[model samples]
Target chain A: SAVISQKPSRDICQRGTSLTIQCQVDSQVTMMFWYRQQPGQSLTLIATANQGSEATYESGFVIDKFPISRPNLTFSTLTVSNMSPEDSSIYLCSVVGTGPLAGYYNEQFFGPGTRLTVL
Target chain B: SQQGEEDPQALSIQEGENATMNCSYKTSINNLQWYRQNSGRGLVHLILIRSNEREKHSGRLRVTLDTSKKSSSLLITASRAADTASYFCATQNQGGSEKLVFGKGTKLTVNP
Candidate 1:
């Protein structure tokens, strides 16, 4: 199990503004992911942040809207650009530990989310 | 696109009773994992059941997987008020990079 923490647990921002959330992990992890959870809905993967590489955004999400920077193996930042009311939701960061196999037994550990409310 | 779908959007159960939730996925997976999220908190990993294994248990939680049917179920015995939370099932797609696709969760409310 990993101890993950996210900055700005809750924030209220005006429309058109941007909010950057930080995620820190206690230990080094192989893969880090970002997800969005709309109220009363399932989570949607936003992107996968790979250290020293560009983040891979999922369909319907782009780097322009959500820029991600993974400086090292234990830290990453996600900036929600040009916030809108529709963008208000909980953003969570998840990581998969280095397992015995390259891709086997991949269990995700999530950070305490950052709740952003756009007014 | 979502791969898993959980049954019973919501459930209310009395403390000391058992709570059960089911999940169905679209494709074969390496493993299926269950997660629990308390209100206003991050998701906590509960248990994981591999495709080759039929069942797995941890503490009071039990998970069973049926690869032939592409479905899984989670059972919580002796529920308590603290057990009130949202439960989700995630499937690890076979082959590709190990990315997990999650399903809409089951909101379980254990009333004391």
Candidate 2:
């Protein structure tokens, strides 16, 4: 398993502002993903951040709203641009551990998460 | 798109009892995994059952998968107050897609 950490554990931002959450892993990983969980709801995948490449977003999510950057294999960032009250939720980053087959049933390790409260 | 749906949105059980949660998915998958999440915390991976495997156990956790029916179940034995948290099931397709689609989740509250 990898030790993951996120910066700014919790923050309160005004509407229309932007917040960038950082995820750092102790060891290098092959894939990194971003997810959002609304109040009392299941997690929704926002995008997959790849080093030195563009992010792949899920349906109903766009790059303009959630811009992601993965400059290296061990670090990634997701910026919630132009925040709104609806954007208040828990943002998480997860990475797949280095296991046999490199893409097998390897478990995913998650960061502590960044809690954003848009007022 | 969401691939799995968990039954009994919420469950309340007394400590020392066993807790069971079921998950049903829409499409075929390579494996199904169970995860636990405490309030205001990140999810912790519990167990994973491959499509070819019918049952698997890890400590107090037991997971069973029925690929033919596209469903799975997670059983937590000797539940404790510490087990009061949300449980989710995720599916990974056989197509080698690293992405995992999760279900809504079952909020299990093990009362002390």
Candidate 3:
């Protein structure tokens, strides 16, 4: 299993400000993704953070709002731009496990998550 | 417009009892996965059942898939208070970039 960690476990930012959440994995991973979980709602994919390339965003989400960067296999970052109360949610980074343990299911390992509160 | 939908939005059970949650999806899938989240935290993968397979088990978790009905169920035996959390079902489409469509979760509360 891969150990994933995210920076600034929780933060409060003013509207119109941007905060970058960092994710670091203990080992190399094949695929990295970003997701957002709103209060009392299910998780939604924000984008696929590809290594050394632009991210692939899901519907209703765009590069201008959620910019992602994956410089290497072990690290990635997600920046939530133009903060608003609606944007306040839990941001998580996940990686596809490639080792023997996770091969059967291709299970995803998730970081602790960054709880953002936009005021 | 979510791909998956879970039934019985919330469930409360006594410890040592069994808990069952059902999920239904719309399209052909490569696999169905079960995940658990506690107190609005990151999810933990519980188990995965492939499209071709009917059932899979892990520890206290049992997952069954019925492709004909486009549904799946997760059964947890001997539930514990620590097992209280929200459970979500995710589907991976037959052909895609490994993205998962999640369902509205079933929140389980086990009373000790």
TM-score of chain B taken alone, every candidate: 0.97, 0.97, 0.98
For model 2, how does the per-residue alpha-carbon lDDT over A12-33 read when each residue is reduced to its tens digit?
9999999999999888889899
CAPRI grade, predicted model 2: medium
Residue B47 Cα positional deviation in candidate 3, in Å, after optimal superposition? 0.4
In the predicted model 1, the residue pairs found to clash are none
TM-score top scorer: 3
**Over all chains combined, what TM-score does candidate 3 have?**
0.97
| Model 1 bad stretches (over 4 Å) | A99-104
Q: Quality of candidate 3's docking, in CAPRI categories?
A: medium
Clashes of each: 0, 0, 0
iRMSD for each candidate structure, in the order shown: 1.1, 1.1, 1.3
Model 3 ranges with Cα > 4 A deviation: none
Q: How many clashes in candidate 3?
A: 0
Model 1, B8-112: lDDT tens per residue? Answer: 899999999999999999997999989999885788888878889999999999999999999999999999999999999999888876678999999999999
Can you write out model 3's per-residue Cα lDDT over A11-94, one digit (the tens) per residue?
999999999999998888889999999999998999999999999999999999999999998899999999999999999998
lDDT of 3 by residue, B1-112 (tens): 4788998799999999999999999999999989999998888889989999999999999999999999999999999999999999999888866888899999999999
Question: Which scores better on TM-score, 2 or 3?
Answer: 3
Name every residue pair that clashes in candidate 2: none
- Per-residue lDDT for B82 in model 1? 97
Model with the higher DockQ, candidate 2 or 3: 2
